[model samples]
Target: MAYKELIGSFDEVRNYIREFFIYGIKKRSDFSDKSGRTYDNRRRQIESWLDGYMSFQQSASGKAQIISVDSREVVHNPLYKAFKTKNFSDYDILLHFCILDMLAGGKELAFRNIAGELQEYGFSGEENVINERTIRLKLQEYEKLGILKVRTEGKKKQYYSLSADAVDLVSWQDAIEFFSETEPMGVVGSFLLDRKELAGCQSNFWYKHHYMLHAIDSEIVETILEGIAEKKYLELVTSGKKHSEEKIKLYPIKLYVSTQNGREYVLGHVSGASGLDFIRVDRIKKVKTGIRCGEYQKFENEYQASKSYLWGVSSGNAKDITHIEMTVRAAEGEEFIVRRLEREKRNGHVYKITDQQYKYVVDTYDAMELMPWIRTFMGRIEKLESSNPQLKKKFDQDMEQLYSMYFGEAQNDIS
Candidate 1:
């Protein structure tokens, strides 16, 4: 047989095995009726090939052993139940698994090698193609989380096995455990599952804390997003414990994600607010269509211009931009801070912070909404500066007074 023909035959056999594992089949004999030499020859070939494959997998340092379902007892865990109930798709999970399988043995396979193996596994189709960059990013994420270590050898790359503690599976139980701890709810959990690169078993602590879905009704949120895309105006009532009594008018434009809280907020032009205002969808009550938004075209320029300073979607009407500066002392091993600063610089922002210490200035219209972020950096922040000297003095005095109040209370209690 030609080499190409042999490769094709082996691929077909591998596919059959995958199908067999996914669907319980007793044996290849269950489907074949040709007895004697023909049956025995094919069976022996398959068995030998499978044994060799399993051997290769076992010897690979970072390889996850493919579990034989028939030999193992499958548990009906909550994670599994949720995955089944949701009918979640695992295409991305499978793709990553295949890549990990190929990159086993601490080998730094080329992007072409990874992509070719995926193609051989029937992952690539005319309409569905996976790019090299996507694979590189997924591998990078694994490396960052300590699941895999990546090394470059003058263009050719290799990945080393980093202890197996971070490895995870893609079944329903594993999905549940991953999401329950990472995403607190189904909306974000479903979104996470949809991304093939992100569906891996490894977990990132910062990602879990920053990718949370806010307390918004998924269906209603989708409707709001659709409405914004279609350029329709909405009359909605705020319905949370705090905003229940408030009625508001809004022209929905953009959806904003809060990095600190992992919550999603809607940013649009509120009728009464001076500029763009952000409202949490979870807090929105009776939302109804009001106008067709024919005259709202004029606001597009203002909206487009405001996006530069609109961090987390709450754009205020402060023409005087505040130059609030703070220095952050990143914890040891926290190189993500440097990456974040680089990203900010790429986006045309002035990020003068380094790996050890960083400084940033945000032009926030409503300073109150930025307080939570300030609190997060309280432990790490050593220096605070403002463009306006008077404002700086006032901020300093406020901090001093606040600290003094807490300190005085502590002394009184001690006495």
Candidate 2:
């Protein structure tokens, strides 16, 4: 099958990776949800980004095609490359250069002047004719991106590049290099390093588990960030098992990264909704600019308050707080167990009822999120209870099932 060459959005790239590489061995015909052309387009796009790690095999007599990946041979995940971002049209690249070139070292100009300059100096690739409307739209976009500064005289709006007089790079070089390699928003540091012509020079920072996908990760982040910066509502399009697409208008407050899992989340208030919501960045298929949504400081402050007691992102209801208690035996050489409980308990309280006994208590919005942590104590947990009795009952059932699986067999042996 001939591969389609068009590059789609990050969501397309992400889903294709999940389908063909992670939970792969899927038949080409199985992708009925997408057009044959679209499926091929997505497959080709994935090949462009992850060519080294991807391969396809055929069924008996070559009746079907199945895609797969073998990570054992790959040294690094190529998914993080900037190219995996939404494919840019030729016009986008052309305008970026033409507009910046015309505005750079020249007086502020409108779209007509820029379009005329492009018409005279000529555009590269595809269409050569100038479209003033497209130019105006791109200029407005650049103005929003801070790539161009706009000025208004009476009614006319003029734009210019935000000055190329190299930013003061003397003191920021070391910091930029280090940050670019390790931190979120570090690409700015990377660009600074590139500008300084020191990109490949060795640095002290190195991460063994590089989240290369975060390159695409931050692409989504930059949008919510733009909303946060402007204090506006953002249009978020997400896909789910039930809904083909779920559209959300969010007053984006802050981004939350999971410590247990390296997932990025946008914590915000649903437009017109009363409580904070956590939206995973990976699930986001699209983001668009929206009208001003007023101040986020109130929600930001409330979210911060929730953070004090939040164990994880599974806050069921904003007002629903459940108190959980787990009594564990902490005697003799196992004092480290109590110390560990103290260290990992976040805002939970740890009290010693007796020298050999202790109870770990926490009031949380999602008592269920703490179950895996409770299970870590195993045989030491003498009692487990939660103000949410349903949680307690579920835990009892799980533990009883576990006991029967192991101890029930032992009882049979004793009989």
lDDT winner among the candidates? 2
Look at candidate 2 and tell me the lDDT of residue 227. 89
TM-score, one value per model:
0.41, 0.68
Deviation from native of the Cα of residue 288 in model 2, angstroms: 2.3
lDDT values of the candidates?
Answer: 0.53, 0.70
Weakest ten-residue segment in model 1 by summed lDDT: 74-83
lDDT tens readout by residue for model 1, 79-106 = 2121222222355577657767776665
- Winning model by TM-score: 2
Query: Per-residue lDDT for 1-415 in model 2, tens only?
Result: 6664545555566666655555453556767775888777776666665555555565663333333433343333345443435557778888888777777774677556676788766663466765678878888898876777777766765645554455676556667655654455655665566554665555545455454445455667878898888888999888777538889899988777765545788888998777788898878878977998656678778777787677888654546899888899988888999999999887888999999999988889888888888878888889888888887777777777786897773232211
* Stretches of model 2 off by over 4 angstroms after superposition: 1-15, 18-27, 55-77, 82-144, 147-198, 202-217, 271-274, 294-309, 317-319, 327-339, 351-359, 379-383, 389-415
